[model samples]
Target: MTYTGEVTVGGPPDTREAGDLQITKIAVGPMANNAYLLRCALTGEQVLIDAADEAPRLLELIGDGGLARVVTTHRHGDHWQALSAVVEATGAETVAGEDDADELPVPVDVRVRTGARVRVGSCELEVIEIVGHTPGSIVLAYDDPDGITHLFTGDSLFPGGVGRTWSPDDFIRLVNDVETKIFDRFDDDTWFYPGHGDDSTLGAERASVPDWRARGW
Candidate 1:
């Protein structure tokens, strides 16, 4: 689905705020990848996730520069298509999963591992590595002060199921990791933002976990 262009072309058309954190979503590139802008309301420190495509548009969203960093969730080319452009334009520090760092076009200033945290002002997002999609796929989880949890799941968990896997073994590993690291950890209210398409709640997707595993996709 093509985004309204309200967000992808210029600024955020739909922005969600909770406690001290704010999230804005934009769909860009041929794959309709979802790029996110996460901001700390109190400190105004912001971080961009995915950088997907359309360098000029992504740079515009970053503006003059309150951007603290840019974190690529995985190594897929589409996910980092605009990485170099954004880095050159804003000089923001780049971060990526340690396992996928070498696959990225630009060098990653910080290598992230499971349990590492990325701070956005007063709030923080904890990284949880979920392998299988690309071996370095990760999901960022932030627990809000208001009792809500927000997750930025790269290509790991999607609206309906886990990310596409090449084989049965890959599918099993992805599903198991997601169940152990994610499903067992968070509650129903946790909101997850995927690499493509709309957001979903952990509660909304819990029932399908069994079905997803059985299908082995």
Candidate 2:
């Protein structure tokens, strides 16, 4: 009954309640991409992050509540495999990072930059753009009234290290951005949900920053 943030392609989603919001995470596609469905407890307005794959299953999760918007964290094919399908079915507005918006399968209705806010009823998620993994990969931050921070990091970050980068400069840039913009700004109790695999707290991974930087990955 606990929310572990571990999910398989066909497994039931993991849901967590944070103040006025309900966060549901499910894995889909062969790449095991994680798609998050955020519902506003106050008004029942919903928003989805990454329509990764499995349109039918994602739709089932959406159910009769309908979806207001779909935010794609990056332009990676795996992350938006079902974007067009899901959007067509739900009529949800498409949101993505400004630099990567054009690369998605569907037209991006909202091109967001760092510090931009997306709404779900009365709740708001601030966008943080992290380069390297993709030109405009984003991480959404939700500051709950209950004194918790929840981050949905696309491929820009993971449990043990940051996302994969093609060059040394990119790796450095990614790590620096993550440290300054994310780690430094948020507290240790901040919980992060990655694009793939499990989730971890900043405190749990804080000590490994130097190690991750030294490896140059």
Candidate 3:
């Protein structure tokens, strides 16, 4: 059996209205980490996905209150570095996959398992545990009331590449998971947003997967 986790990234928000969920990408840290600010359209509930490693700079971006949650994609230093500070400053609870949940010093308010959902305002978020990038890497997908689905693939999948797998076992497992689980589940139009680089879609990459596996990357 293969692990099943798929994501579909949708188009960007055209309007930033009071009830429109918008995601702003902030490229920060030495590694050029892409931290995200997910603003809720209805209750104005906002969440941070992988805070800025440069603490001072991140604080400046969402300086004030209103941060509802801090969702860590994984336990990497670059991703979790600002978790504690952000939670303290914004009074937001932290959430992550159960396997890597311990990465946070403090207990995570929500432990995401496969098929778990997180709803904020008018947007609903789905969690998919994607290992191999790390033991506990996961992807996030947000579906608006209008039926647009967007994926937030952490370090699992990339634009022109996939996350490096030092072990052959891990590599094969990860690849199979993405193929049988993710790529097989979604439609061709599903959008893909990786942790690094720009976005792609399941439909676009699904066609090239054979070539991808052929290269043994």
Candidate 4:
């Protein structure tokens, strides 16, 4: 996928091709929510993550290719502001975590749990349910044949620390999930895409986990 000129919110959408997957990132809405389009280069099947905002722009990215599914990272309003519009325009199925599915404005087509596999073309993205950001916050992990892993973390993990939590218990749960489910399972080269900001890698954030947990954030 190629894009030119200014994007909906950020300067330009970031695109990376890893093996069979072509990932494109676009910032949308006043909140600068990151919406991603993951396409399988081999089969041309596409899946969108977080229809954050600016439906027309996201639809433009999909173009004539059509979208098979749109996955919401969590139930936050900012993440799904454009969800209804995009689904209406493309008739794509909606997928969300089972715990957060009922909180969404529209009915969820597929309620995914941790370890569930979401198919994109011939590729399969494993679902990891990480709570704290929300009771059902989740991240999508795709292990490429090349041995690199691509993570789509909603608001669960970020560059310097994990997602914000209101209580210490929530923070602990998120931290544990990040360490066990994400950090431990993937290698340092694992690339993580976040919901509202730039991307980060597990290698970059690995060493800082201890500090983040100590500070209790």
Model 1 spans with C-alpha error above 4 angstroms? 1-12
lDDT of 4 by residue, 79-192 (tens): 999999999999999999999999988789999999899989989999999999899999999999986999999999988999989999999999999999999989999988
lDDT of 2 by residue, 1-217 (tens): 8889989999999999999999999999789999999999999999999999999999999999999999999998999999999999999999999999999999999999999999999999999999888889999999998879999999888999999999998898899989999999999999999999999999999999999999996
Which residues of candidate 3, in runs, are more than 4 Å off? 1-19, 63-65
Candidate-wise lDDT, in order: 0.87, 0.95, 0.70, 0.90
Give the candidate number with the greatest TM-score.
2
**TM-score per model over all chains:** 0.93, 0.99, 0.85, 0.95
**Candidate 4, run of 10 with poorest lDDT:** 1-10
Superior candidate under TM-score, 1 versus 4 = 4
On residues 119-140, what C-alpha lDDT tens digit does candidate 1 reach at each position?
A: 9889999999999998888899
How far does residue 100 in candidate 3 sit from its true spot (Å)?
Answer: 0.8
Instruction: Please report how far candidate 1 places residue 95 from its true position, in Å.
Output: 0.8
lDDT of 3 by residue, 106-213 (tens): 579999987998766567788888777778778888755554567788788886656778787777777877787678877777666666556677877887777767
Each candidate structure's count of clashing pairs: 0, 0, 4, 0
* lDDT-best of 1 and 4: 4
